[model samples]
Target: MSAFLADRDSARFELRFQSLFNAGHVVSFPCNAAGQVDLDALSERERDRYLYARAVVGGVFSLPQKQRRLD
Candidate 1:
């Protein structure tokens, strides 16, 4: 793996997509500090969700927010 991927693997972060219409609904994926997700690290279902989230930004979901994992 490249250095970038290696650094990301050790970080605990998430890219969160909050629903534009819903108050508490959120979709999140594992990501690096810069909000970059490793598609190869996700399962098939998760990969699909990630792509869907990207497609719906600004329509169904607001812009993604990068946050460090609390746990």
Candidate 2:
């Protein structure tokens, strides 16, 4: 029971995440100092990685943790 319950805590976070805000602001599609992407650096493999992951917007999160401890 201890092993199963303890391990399940980490299982709750199987999803991986990446924040593009800083990167998106720094890079661009046509490769500019402040407003474009570096086509040369965009790998097909990297694009596929994004396609597989979930997309989030406005710094939102699902299921806020219970604030009050259960009795």
Candidate 3:
């Protein structure tokens, strides 16, 4: 793999879509430092959630935030 792709694959960051009305509700996906998600790397269910989160950004969720993974 290219260095860029390899770096993204090993990223320890996530893109978090926080619910606007719910303080504790969030949908997150593994992502690189720039908040780029690798759709091909996600499972079927996860891909669906990611798409859903993107679709409802203003209505159901806040703008996505890039966060470092603790684990």
In each prediction, how many residue pairs overlap at the backbone (N, C-alpha, C within less than 3 A)? 0, 6, 0
Q: Which candidate order results from sorting by TM-score in descending order?
A: 3, 1, 2
Give me the displacement of residue 2 in model 3, in angstroms. Answer: 8.9
lDDT value for candidate 2?
0.31
Candidate 2: where is the Cα deviation over 4 Å? Answer: 1-31, 49-55, 59-71
Residue pairs with clashing backbones, model 1:
none
What lDDT tens digits, residue by residue, belong to model 1 across residues 1-71?
Answer: 64656994436999999999996999999888778998888889999999999999999999999998878
Cα error, residue 63 of model 2, in Å, equals 22
Flag the better candidate by lDDT, 1 or 2. 1
Model 3 residue 1 distance off true place after TM-score fit, in angstroms: 7.7
Order the candidate numbers by lDDT, best to worst. Answer: 1, 3, 2
TM-score of each: 0.86, 0.23, 0.87
Residue lDDT tens for model 3, 25-55? 9988888777888888888999999999999
- Runs in model 3 deviating more than 4 A are 1-5
What TM-score does candidate 2 reach?
0.23
